[model samples]
Target chain A: MWKKSSDRFEYLQTLVTEFQDTDIEEAKEQVLANLANFAYDPKNMEYLKQLQVTDLFLDMLTEENENFVEFGMGGLCNLSMDPECRDIILQNSGISLVTNCLSSQREETVLSAITTLMSLLTPLSRSEITHPSILHCMLRFSLSESPRLRNLAAVFLQDCCTEEQVAQAEQQMQGQQTAVGIPLPQD
Target chain B: MAAPVGNSSGCWSVPEVYKHHEQRKVCISRPKYREGRKEKAVKVYTINLESRYVMVQGVPAIGVMTELIQLCALYGVVEEYRPLDEYPAEEFTEVYLVKFQKLTSARAAKRHMDEKSFYGGVLHVCYVPEYETVEDTRLKLQDRRRYVIRTAQNRAREKEKQERSNEDPTTSDTTTTTEMTIVEYDKTCDSDNTGEAQQTSYMSHYSSFPPLPLPPQEHNFYGHTNQQGNIQTEDKMGTLHNAIINTKQQLQKSTSFSQNSSDRDRGTEQRVTPNQASAVRFVPRTAHLENRKRKMAKEATEISLTDVSGKNEPLIGPKLPEPPKLDMEDVSLNTTVSLIRNTMKQVESVPDLKPLEKKIKPRRRI
Candidate 1:
């Protein structure tokens, strides 16, 4: 029994080290995906927390490569399901970084960002998460033509924020709204 | 963006086939330690990738929709099923979309049905999240979060119980490290009360996770420890037929409890009035737009009522105080003022009446 746990720890450590040492973008993406899939299992949550993979995922949010942002966002979305990992993400100021992905060109990335935001919700972080600007972004997303995006944004609005907040955001939207979730211009 | 798949009107639009639906090549070069029991492509599974609406492709076109649905019903209650006539398919094959009542049921159905051979056709199943409505998406995430939190709390409680039991043995020096490890290791070996012959092989590995606390009430209904380990060995041996036959029996027993509860809820729902039932089924797209418009209209009235100065105030900041009431020294004048004020309120409430009227119009038309 102990041997299996040690084997898992070693395997995760290998992936983490490979992610740091490899310069090739493809390898890094694969390893990032590997680590993220591992995070989905609750049994591996303690090991992932020990490896500081939360910080690794947070760092990927600001990269120029869209794949990095998407895969990393996906990893955080899965990891944040655990309360322990959610606290670590909150401590790292993950709210602002994840919010930046709201405007990503890739729909997968935006979807992951929305789910990660919902999972990152805590009493202490509620105000920042439900900030007027974020709510404004969700308001835009709730009207998105893509049903997946519309549904997730609706969940965020319905579950994460109060009805008054949504109403206020809607009112503000009519006069002047921020460009948070609008898609980036494609070259 | 993918088009909406189907609506409550029982009509389906052509669904855009997504990249995730195409299964990638199985990654084979992983070192022995990193490989899971089954070879899988390098893709991550998140809540975004899962849905109660699953798409099934490669079904034989020989009028087998009932047989296909019955196969799906083995996993859970099939809420809705329809063949996607517009979706592109291979020659002599068809595609179908099935919506299970619960996400877990969809998952189990996908796991069991995908890549399995049916009547002269191989089935390929994948989650089609684009087909879900906003309410379905919201309920899925809420249920997943609640399940994770509940399991985490249970695991933590079990750990605490194990620690307390270990502490009772020795109160002296070396209370911190070695003895605790030894005691935990010992418990793993001794805790296999399930003398099922199939479990004896992999019982050691399975013992570490679920039954760590050992005594009081661990072996009630969660046959997970029994099936998980035995299933793995069965997979490796290429006897999936036996593995499924053995596990399906146990899976159905555990899943039936949940099905019974859901069925009771469905029974109560059947008792609802037809109008209410239709309302629950058909959530109009215009509903959100109308809700927002209604709220805006109400806000406008509120602003107009509060700002007696008759100027639009910025929606932000503290609301303006109501204008002071005019007074008349004569009783006849005071009564006249009250009458005017009552007439003004009735006029002001006219906008509020519009929303209710609009609401009833949509319901009656549907």
Candidate 2:
């Protein structure tokens, strides 16, 4: 069984390369379909996960965007550990992908994706988030028409706001100790 | 020799298609099927990204269809890049950028590739029809999307029916009970799967989080994801990837291609849809952006000091010759607090010094 999976792993790497070939469009479909079957099958999924094949699957597939969204949250969560994986997600997927994932009509899936993307950022990146467009998207995402989507985007947006709020809270605590009334400055 | 070209700094094998400025050949060392050969870890793929997207959707209206031109051209192209100079000569070419972009969305990109032959595939080389605007692209995609999804949906239903028929008769009879269960495959979740993405919201602490598992249902979620998210995610990623590849290919295609290639869409800004705020704009939470916020905070402190310094001249100058020094500490955090504490300490110490001064001054005066 182990050997079979290892063989499949080796085969998947080849499939990914072959999938890249321009002439193998049907083969590409077959490869992804096969991988998808493996991905969807619970028995295989356990072994695949143990092998940490999600990362490879992400790398090899390179282009299964929407399918990835369902477990995007989990993918992002898993990627949070592997810095390279996280960077690839951010770089390839980018903010647009992030936003689209958040705003997806598939509320539960996109919510997880959005929140997970937000988590993937290192603390430094998390603190400095300032894309005004992201702010706008967050609003639309909150109105995601799906409660699950709304909450997910909200959680993500709130996470983005955390650093600023943390700084503000620290500032307010300092003001209370002073002799005279010191106003807590707002940004 | 004069320009000084040779092996790159890395020890591993690099997949170079060519050597000199003249003849470019990519010597990609295939991974050794045998064990223990060195140079196996180097990832030769131009883009080291895992997984891309494909979304195919019915454009409800021609109005939305108008957005297709931008979508068609810009969807899967690499948005972030340094420049062509960053890559080794002939070793890297963007010729397949568009086709590779289709890889992001298997079906949607495939559909687009079907219409526009970016390469000489099994069917023979074909040219993608030109789209001028989002609407043009959308109209084209809408027509294709409608046909694709319907066909896909039909296929999916048939496949499900077949699978159901193949199941054990005893289990099939229990329509209410599902024998299948959702499960996690590995340490990582596809995250790309929208079904599992929904539950990720459960972890809000943003620390020690887990990944989404595959969704279990009557329908094979993966089977339908192409029909569902394919045009959306796949089409976008494929177009964008193609745009990047095409840009490179065109540069190689003709001298005129450079002008067109340089005219690559400023899709970066358009692609960045800030959460909840297309009206407000979304800021990516990256380290540089975070550091920028810190710098902004520091600047705000300086501005506040400038204002306070402007007001401070009259009230502090005469009484406090050291006012400038204290004012200097205004914008700083820890130091400023310390300065204020020291100032208050000096104020307390003043009374104690007066009695000692009285004794010393009287003796001196006498």
- Candidate number of the best lDDT: 1
Q: Using DockQ as the measure, which candidate wins?
A: 1
Q: Name the top TM-score candidate.
A: 1
- Candidate 1 local lDDT, B1-366, one digit each (tens): 112233364124567777778988887765565555667776777888898789999999999988888888776556678888888999999999987655655776787799999899999999998887655665466445544443444454454456567656543332333334334433432332233443453333233222111111222323333443343322221133533343333233223322322332332232224533443343222233433554465566545545542123222111101112234556686676668655644655221111101111111110
CA lDDT scores, all candidates in order: 0.61, 0.31
Enumerate the candidates' DockQ scores in order. Answer: 0.13, 0.04
When candidate 2 is compared with the true two-chain complex, its DockQ is 0.04
Stretches > 4 Å off in candidate 2: A22-30, A33-84, A90-97, A100-109, A127-130, A163-187, B1-366
TM-scores of all candidate predictions against the true structure: 0.61, 0.26
lDDT of 2 by residue, B64-172 (tens): 3223323433434322111123223332122111122222232233333332422221211111111112222222222222222223223333434565688655534
iRMS of each prediction: 19.5, 25.5
